[model samples]
Target: MKISYHSPHEPNCSICKKQCRFYDSLREHLIGPLPKAECAKQFSERGCSLCLKVFPTAQQLNNHRAACQSLPPLPAISGLRPSLVNKRNQAEKEQILEESSNKSNISGIAMDCEMVGGGRDGSLDLCARVCLVDEEEKVIFHCYVRPPIPITDYRYDVSGIKPEHLMGGMPLKQVQEKIQQILYNGEAIWRIRLKGGKAKVLVGHDLDHDLQCLGLEYPTHLIRDTAKYIPLLKSNKTSNSLNYLTQSFLGYKIQNGTHDPYEDCVAAMRIYKKMRNEDHSLSATEFVPENGVYSRMRQKELEKMSPEALLQISQSDFYCWCMDSR
Candidate 1:
């Protein structure tokens, strides 16, 4: 007698949901033991084989592939081109000089420029006027710079330069030069005096950037940055804000509306004077230069010598010391 073996539920093709001859065959198809020829053909017809998403045309599929493999476009070469680079540089230099010349009348002006951002890409947009005071602490020069870059952030509201002010403002190069001239001229006057007597210092908080922004080179020895003297803030703390330092040292809070450059410059100078005064009062010690290998060997030999021999060598060195001092 013949017997039929059948599952109570008929097994169907996994890909198409069509009934198959045997459960084993259906299992093999579903488990992918044997490749589905029709499914493979269907996948080949569509552009995306993995997802089987079809595109209208082969060109669209090729275009998508090209896009996936393509790289981003690079920035336009600003300085390398023969046509535009030199002209741009000359324009920038002239603009800087013009601004500096315009602000020449202001005595000891302390100016700060606010830019759209901090990095190289960001352009200067606002200027904070700082009028330098005399020894009595009176304002001598004050004026805000209207920036050219559009202000996108509301945080600049405290900077006291409105959008209306910047709408018809000058280029940043001009403003930067103006600030530089004010600072450098103030420092230069004292430097010239020091040439006949003692060196005068250009004092500032994080002044390197300020000097750099102005396109001026300052002697490292003559310049003093307040940010450097306070070791605790340099090593331990993250923030070195002028506001925090001024409040801590001067016992006065910087006003919230706009940063006064004059006040900042004064604070920096005060800090520098304090440090210098402390330095001058310290006792001096003789500094010995490291001797050559032969000298070092001689030193070791001297160390091994008897007390009488060492004393004799010391006496001989007295003549050498006198010659060196002369």
Candidate 2:
């Protein structure tokens, strides 16, 4: 059955990038009535029946399925059962993650913030808690925030925040200072912004909102927003929720119960790493120097271009995470 909400996190077809309300809808788009011709053809050749992921070749698909079948079921983070699936998966990935960490010079820091409602009718967002994790998914910082104004609504239904948690929470000013200091990684903010220093790349889903709630700012070029990444977006080009993106890409479900900032941080970091690790075929040299060439093209010309062609001309605007590997 197709999902009805048309959630912002709508699942996108792995092959053609068409947006669908759910996996079932994606399956329909791939192999159902009135299927997309190119996508359907590609899906039929290499798509995984279980996870709907399309592999690059028949041999890889067979190998992936054999391993996929024997793997433990993906743990649902939404369950309040206090299971170890997320942890176990993280532990398993450490071996893989270490391969990258052992050699890479990148400084990627993933963070997430929980907001509580303030002001009249509790409409204003106040930073209630925040968590930051390194590439290793190790918690570098995790603290409940003491908002300037009392939290009128803890948003506990989602945030799981309570008065007790804020009783000794870190002050907002201090939290901001700490986060900025960590992100700046000892360099002055100005130095990092001018590309003169090795500022940590901040990774998160919907970072704009989180940064706003925390009253902090960072250089846009140094930020990696998983929500805004073109490839991770819904076929309709909307941002997918962290929950959907995590389960789809990370092989686990999260944000299922009491929201854990750590879970979200880890999810965004894992997705960033996953995308970074892909063997993209395009060379940076093939791409146009900037995005201006794309805007100059007529609509029909744009429409006629293939995805690869458009990508070749969209170097400036996209600034995709994969390019960071360079």
Best by lDDT: 2
Cα lDDT tens digits for candidate 2, 1-326: 11123222334677766655445567668778898899888888998764677899999998987754322223223232222322245455445344333333548989899888999899999988788788877766667788998778889888987787676677889888778777776456788767687678899999999999999988888889988876677757788888887776656678776778888888898878877765444533533334434333455565786764554343323554666887
C-alpha lDDT of residue 172 in model 2: 89
- Candidate 2 regions exceeding 4 Å error are 1-33, 36-45, 49-59, 65-106, 283-317
Best by TM-score: 2
Each prediction's Cα lDDT score? 0.41, 0.70
Q: Which RMSD does model 1 reach against the true structure?
A: 31.5
lDDT for position 29 in model 2:
81
TM-score of each: 0.42, 0.69
- Candidate 1 C-alpha lDDT tens digits along 1-326: 11112211233343464444332344334334464777544434543421123355777766655433312112222113322322335566456444443454332222233333322443442332223332223333233334344445424545444444444344556655444444455344456446742322455677667655444465565555555542214224343676655554444465456544555656664444433432111111121223412355455655676643332222111111112112
Q: Which runs in model 1 stand beyond 4 Å of their true positions?
A: 1-141, 166-200, 212-217, 230-239, 255-258, 279-285, 288-326
